[model samples]
Target: MFLGVDVGTGGTRAILVDRDGRVVVSEACEHQPIHSAEIGWAEQDPDDWWHAAKTAIGGVMRWARENGKAVESVGLTGQMHGCVMLDADGKVLRPALIWCDQRTQPQCDWLNETIGYERMIELTCNPALPNFTLTKLLWVREHQPEIFAKIAHVLCPKDYVRYKLTGEYAIDMQEASGTLLLDVTYRRWSTEVAAAAGIPMSWLPSLFEGPEVCGRILPEASSVTGLAAGTPVVAGAGDQGAGAVGMGILEPGSVSATIGTSGVVFAATAAPTKDAHGRLHTFCHAAPGIWHVMGVTNGAGLSFRYFRDTFTPQLGYDDLTALAAKVPAGSDGMLWVPYLFGERTPHLDPDARAAFIGVTASHTLGHFVRAVLEGVAFSLKDTFTLFEELAIPVEKIRLGGGGARGPLWRQIQADVYNHSVELLEAEEGGAFGAALLAGTGVNAWPSVQAACAATIRAAAVIPPTSAAAMQAAYPRYRRIYPALKGVFQA
Candidate 1:
């Protein structure tokens, strides 16, 4: 059996699976999110992610050992675009500049305008955004120049974990693509991007394919994680790349939809494609030569978290979703713009705040609940529409993430997106995707397509039912941002 370790911002999880992607055992360790109180900034200790990863992997390995399963390779997937700085001894300099940090907006705006937005996007297949690593580095250089000057190697959350295990300093193509320094067209770092961003090319780690066997666990790592010393560590991709593998979306016209801490609508393509408006991002595929265009919503599973904390403090998510079902579609003309933490795709507005639009005296908690749900799905549809514009066909979407745990929300996703939403029998989306790549890298599977065919599970599919209403409602949904766009900048 192979192992897949997923290190996310909130938690780390490890799963033991057979060649067919049937999980035999799995375990997770979740931690509290660390936040900076200076407003609109979030961070996590790299040590915390490592500890949780070890705990999860150790627990799963113990279970696998008890069950008499032999380990082969291990692959990792993680939250993307985080910036982790390592000192001379490979120790973390500070809390990671996490994917959600918004302090780099000014830097992003300056780079986007100064670097010639069209040329950058044409070369990189992505535009400057505050959440990406380049902007984070610029922010650090401007605000904490002293600390920025003393960096040894820069890494993402997954790459840092990989370094701890393998004693190798490297990142994979898929994750590196999020750094905004890599050449999306050439599949290497661009000298022009590095120079323009005022970053030295040497700060970047060596890049590899997601499935490349970078190294094995060192003795110390093995002792902590209970894996064999020579266990192969594959260069796994970012969450979206891995999730696409797990969802069988590596094929053209295939799509993956994840609504977890955030939502994403991603379509894999044989070639890199970008929206003219930069409403979507294109990244290197875990499938190597391929690329994936993605539209990200800043809030996805988070909106449900907000509602849970706001209304049903004592109720389970299932029960709360049941209450949401009591309300009809469209929430009786009520709309919600879930930009609680600003937005990514469609609107790069960092100052954008959230609101429940069109509230009236007749509205109840149920209405509010459902509107929040539909708002997220509709915003996700916004990404889907952009995918349509780019001509990256999305025939169906494989749904994953914590939000997929709720059946009602799953059904709502089906209705609002007006497409069939499918789920995997195995729960670990990103980790499982990583494992598929590992299997391919090791020649356990002839190709990614074959590995996916062996691993991806089609447990159920939710097809659209109320497409007519959603079609009528979508036009109104499209207008919410334009109306609010000016308000955010002011």
Candidate 2:
């Protein structure tokens, strides 16, 4: 058996997968509410993640033991771009500034100014964004100098938990790419970029390729988590990287459109494909010897979540999706801009806001729900446009996350992109991907690609519907951001 652990935003999950990649049991423990003392700022305690991981792992191990299975290897994956600083003794200095935190815009600006924007992109294959780990470090340095002075190491969210388990300072190449400090072309830390950002090179963790065994569980962690001592732990990718692996997007031309709180259009590439304009991100793939280009929509599923919390607290997601199915293709010409947490791809504007344009008294709650659903699909389609521009092949599109669970959203995605969308038979997302990595780590399979091919199979495919109407409305959806860009600033 293989164990896959994902320290997610809302919870920590542990899955036990058999040799054939069948999931035997899975368990999760929810996290406490994220601390948002100020708008555009988000934080979570590293200790909370550790606690949840322990609980989830122990629960999964108990189930595995009952089934007379022993987990031979473990793989880790989690939220990317979080900044977790530790003191000399490895104690967390403060609450981790998580991925959605937008408090580091000034720091982002400073990094670009200091490093030269083009030069920065040349080194990292990405322009510094507020969500990158380096910008969060700069925010701490500027706002809380005393705390910054005590920093001995800087690790991402999952790596911090890995530290607790193995007492090691290591991170995977895919996770390192999001720090805005790696020489992405070489798959190592960039000393030049680190110096330019005013970060000490010693503070960064050692890098490993995903599926490489980076450490072993210590006796202490083994006692708490109920795993055997000295169990090997693999260096897993960040959530996106692992998720793509789980979806079998291992080779070039294969792509995935995943919608969690955020939406990502990830395409595997033979080489690092740079968008000189810095609109799309090029990062190391979890699969060794490869890279990926991705475009993120900061508020995808988030739009629906916001609507549910604000207007339909009494209803569930299935109910909302069913309601949305009643509405037509374009919601009677009403469009929604799902930029509630600002935009990421294309515009790269942090101050952008969400809006429902062309609303009328004739429209009902169902129209609004459908509009939001279509709007998220439209946002993802923008990435496809960029992919076409970059000449990155998109021969296949696999759907994952909440968007894959509903037929309405699946059809909306297919129609909006005007392409066939596939769903996996074992659609476990990141946790399953992590398990595949674990399988590779123990040589249960020769390579990540071989493991994925042996285990993953597509369950269904949805083709485009009302393609002409979708194609027509997409141009209008593209116009919304430009139309409202000035108003958002005002």
The candidate that wins on lDDT is 2
* lDDT digits (tens) for residues 1-490 of candidate 2: 9999999888999999887879989999999988999878889999999999999999999998787889899999999999999999999999999998988889889988899889989999999899899999999999999999999999999999999999999999999999999999999899999887789999999899999999999999999999999999999999999999999997888999999889999999999999998899999999999999999998998899999999999999999888888888999999998988778898888888899999999999999999999999999999999999989998999999999988999889999999999999878979899999988999999999999989999999899977787888999999888888878464
Q: Determine which window of 10 residues in candidate 2 has minimal summed lDDT.
A: 481-490
lDDT of each: 0.84, 0.93
Off by over 4 Å in 2: none
Clashing pairs in 2: none
lDDT of 1: 0.84
- List, in order, the clash count of every candidate structure: 1, 0
Per-candidate TM equals: 0.97, 0.99
